[model samples]
Target chain A: MSFQPVKFYQTGTFTVGNRLLPPEERSVQAQTKRFNSINSGHRACQGCGEALGARYAVDAAMEAANGQLICANATGCLEVFSTPYPETSWQVPWIHSLFGNTAAVATGIAAALKVKQLKGERRDIRVVAQGGDGGTTDIGFGCLSGMFERNDDVLYICYDNGGYMNTGIQRSSATPPAARTATTLAVGDEPGNLFGQGKFVPAIAMAHEIPYVATATVADLRDLEAKVRRAMAIRGARYLHILVPCPLGWGTASHETIRIARLAKETGIFPVFEAEHGELKSVLAIRRPLPVEDYLKPQKRYAHLFAPKARLEVIARLQQLADRNIRRYGLLEGN
Target chain B: MLKQIEGSRAVAEAVALCRPEVICAYPISPQTHIVEALGEFVKDGTLAPCEFINVESEFAAMSVAIGSSAAGARTYTATASQGLLFMAEAVYNASGLGLPIVMTVANRAIGAPINIWNDHSDALSQRDSGWLQIFAETNQEALDLHIQAFRLAEELSLPIMVCMDGFILTHAYERVDMPTQAQVDAYLPKYEPRQVLDPAEPVSIGAMVGPEAFMEVRYLAHAKQMEALKLIPGYAAEFREVFGRDSGGLTHTYKADDAETMVVAMGSLLGTIKDVIDEMRAAGHKIGVLGITLFRPFPIAQVREALHGAQRVVVLEKSLAVGLGGILATNVRMALSALPIDVYTVVAGIGGRPITMRSLHALFREAERDDIDPVTFLDLNHDVVDKQLARERSTRRSGPAAEAILRDIGVVAAKVAQEVR
Candidate 1:
């Protein structure tokens, strides 16, 4: 297929499509265009991170697979917002799996595609499963692990935005320590999220020693796309965890979604790295390290810590955790 | 075709014959064997052209299935109890998106007390989830229902669940007349997904609907389910014509003609009830039984037409609602709301408790005498509860104040410190 130029409106109104430009220049969802993978009109809140992650991840996968990709999405903010009824934002072959079973569902899709391949009809089809942190970590952990163990030909993606944003920002296992979510209230001394709880599934995936496993941040589109491309190259089970910060759930400024995600990596709160078969292969080095407080203080979800005398000691502990992560991952080399 | 097979294996054969492109699931007890069988098929190549996904939970299982189906691939999965609860959100999504993914529910009891056995409660809880729900009475039916389920689901663009009694139908070995590949192919044609992922045309599957069309969109799904009420029987008839066995589509009745009393039930217990009815019939009792095959549509019209002639209709369901009898009883009451039949409700075999022929016979005798209560807990041991309560009270007086005692252990202090800020 020939490349189409993305259409831009001469008026700075942020409308993506216009009549004058060539159809190739039009946006993916433009009326004149046909390759709109993420269809028009979804229930996603304004500037939803999960939606952005989905659009980018799915479209990139579609392009990489030569437009022969099927997406199995977990039930979360993405599924609810995208397909409300007779409408959807997905332009490719998309499915809405349950919150916990995206990985499994994608595995099934890949299997089905393989069956077609055996029949001598080469469709060049690939499968991808996407979900929010809540669905990926807590509810669907077993299925995810099973996919890893079986090495099913699927690339499962988790858009980690800290909590269960769809169901009223409840605390999920991916929720950072001391973050205020609906279930983990901002009351009591520790205030907002429990300490030393929650599992880091990326590390667990490394233990399984699958073909590929990586972590990306929405802040770095190039890195995210690169990781997705690398994941697509592999045949066995693969996982890509993307740090897509939820503005509504995290109680942060909508535009700061990318900035907060960038800060998260710089602060060593959420590391960006890749591994293969139970071994740490590489870490996306941080040029300058920032204190974890910079990443935490801006979001109202973590605002509880700033108040009640700013909890300097707690901040110190969090900083210590970040420092430990840096040293453990060798996140920075030389001064 | 006539070989000894585990109930789970029988289900796998049926699922394979349906030729689902995607199989997504998390294995929960009683249902694990079915998934295990499917897993082996993926490995051995008995089931080809399928992606067997080992999902993290039932939630993911349903979610992945929805995505695959939306992408225009036939999908299937199985779960029970906790697994079903975990995937509840995806269940609603699959139906809302109109994906037509088929899920096999190995009916098991939910937990608090942590029991694993045959019960309709798990499947019953999701009755309103918009998936076409069918309850299987035997292992053969479990296998056959799965085949019919895929056909019905795809035809209506709706997800479906083939519910069967846990270990009873899932673990038992049975001689099922499996359909040959040619026969199956002829009966169930290849699935060409209605709304599939096509980059050439690029259309979205699940999109966000605004307030303007949200209600209407849901109404469309509701209408499809209502449409299945008619569509199911038509397809079932076609299946019978090809397969040579009548499934009765929604509800199956036995010896209801010229009978004054009828026992209504669902799931594997129907087999035992039928056996007991045979004995009762030979003994010269004017009694019969009606086994409910479909739960979601409730088969309200068929149920009413069948029960209208009977004087006393006994409803046996495996799920309870505290004071309002069983779920099926409530549905039957609503169906027969306009009629004058005396409906007796019995909540039996909950938490996988076995409903034996003796127990069923005794219950039927009670139903015949008009001595049966409107709501009866079939196999509850209340004495155990009374004994446990007495023991707990005796020990409580000797126990120290809750907080003071917890503090003395030093653990409470540590917890307090963590929260103290």
Candidate 2:
């Protein structure tokens, strides 16, 4: 991920303080007039990566669509916290159908807008569907795949927090290998989540050969916003998967959300990249590659592997998976 | 505009005439032909400005309809049996969100034995799903109800399921008075959504309602249906003014004005029941039939009024409540709870068992004599059932009962029955 450097200031870094750069080049969140799509005074936890990710992605989509946007949200932490009955945190046209039908709902909204547009009754109104990993990868997988296959005009954003954090951190299809969840307990010969169990939905989304597919993290707001803007620019099915860590679920510090996401990308465990119509387009190169332990050690879900005996073999296996991702996406500089 | 066509095609044409803006389809048995025709209509520009979405599953089909409908597009979809059950969650969501989406439920029996035949189990299972359910007695009624469905749904901001018997009505070829586009246009005006997903006036729908207001939110859904109970008759009358036919209402009565024995049923089975009633009336047995059109909202007052004059009412339904004999009969009993009328529950045509005129004549005669059982499974093969029950009692592992029954009947006999059909 590259941007033109502002000569006099340190604007090339991933921080939001790029005020010296031209207004158009600055991130949507940096703008004072950015659409606070997911507004304040909600129930999202402290340092909630999903909350940050949703705001960044939706605000960018709102900007890209010129405020002509409707969002269909899947039932998750995002929906539960944002809208509690008579009170709503969303300022834009939004709907939360069910946990597994957000993509299809977005497709319906897009289709409706298109028909209305054709009838000369409405203008260019784009749609975005969003959900958590549980909704996107497990229960909602069929609808997501259908939306992709039909090439429906929907930008589906999956806030991947690795488990069903909203429901007490149960195992989801996106839960990492050997990561403890309520359902996948750290016990027996193989503790935590079983190896080769969970799925990588971004790869599945890419397999659908959609118009756009991208993976981002809260650590890189610029990349996340840019990807969302790029997706909104496309007409057909597009997917943006963001690694949003959960403090309560991951057993990490409330303030470690961004740092953990940064470590995830830097360790090659979660390669931040973008793809266009099934072909790899660009990779966010790791400036300083770190070991998988640097990413996992802070989270108590993985504390079992470090405590009591320090399972070196398990750590080695997790490292191998990270190394595989690095080789697959060529994440490290000059790799 | 009268043509002899398959029931599904007539329905497809009727649905198209309503000018749905979005049609989400997932192929399920019986309802497949209707969507297939609608698909072609969209493909060939017959249904212009309409998006035909072939979704992955019944859940997506309903979910997509929910989205389009909430966005203020007149949306439609169809499913049956397992398909209906598969999309049960979304079905409730669409209604709970108050999206006025119309759907066709090609009524079929639910499975364990896995039969794909016509029954009322599918729609009856969703009786409390906060959607208006209207049963069609004939293919023409099925065709006519869909147009009224859109109008009624949009008018009240409620989802409706126009249930027609699968394979029986969906596959049957019949003459239907297909309404013209001009007539349908005059009848069902352009959809003006009550609440919509528009950027111009943004609103967050499907919010998480807590216990404090969840009951009120649910009560509103019930209120809407109660409101629908009043509005359905007017819509049907207006429909008649345009299309010149009486198609949909709470219930329709045939010869029940001064009759003693009243036979009550719904869907395609009404045609059969009505025919039996006609013969019994001619024989001076003073029998009549009540065809329940709107099953949901139960039409409690109307049902009580209609059956109040009768000495006894035999409720023949195509669905059973398994452990509790009759689904429709239970509701009918509730409707006539204050009256002294003996309501006999006759569960018939279950899993597509043939409800022959011969069997019905005997059943009606028995009911007239007040000698019928409280709950009767019409045309049940008692010998085979008894043999299976005996086998289960004697053997530790009694294999699958459905297969055992099939074997007891003999494969050759089953083959002969299939050939006869």
TM-score for chain A, candidates 1 onward in order: 0.87, 0.95
Candidate 2 structure quality by residue, lDDT tens digits, A85-156: 667999999999999999999999999999999999999999999999999999999999999999999999
Docking class of 2: high
lDDT of 2 by residue, B1-421 (tens): 9999999999999999999999999998989999999999999999999999999999999999999999999999999999999999999999999988999999988998898888999999999999999999899999999999998889889999999999999999999999999999898889999999999999999889888888998999999899988998899888888888888999989999898999999988887888888888888889998889999888999999999999999999998897988999999999998799999999998777778888899999999999989998887778999999999999989998889988998875575486336
Provide the lDDT at B212 for model 1. 90
**Chain B fold agreement for model 1, TM-score:** 0.91
Instruction: Estimate, for each residue in B1-421, the C-alpha lDDT of model 1 and write its tens digit.
Output: 7768989999998888877777876768999988888888877888776777766666657766765676567788899998888778778877887878888999998876567877888898899998889999888888888888888888888889899889988999988888887777887877766676654555655555689978998898888877878987887888888888876388888998888998899988888888999999999999988888988777889898888899999998899876566788889988898788899888887876667777788888888899988888785555554555565677876443433333444574474454323
| Residue runs of model 1 more than 4 Å from their true location after superposition | A1-60, A72-91, A120-122, A131-143, A157-201, A216-221, A241-272, A278-319, B4-6, B24-38, B54-56, B171-175, B282-284, B351-362, B378-421
- Stretches off by above 4 angstroms in model 2 are A1-16, B412-421
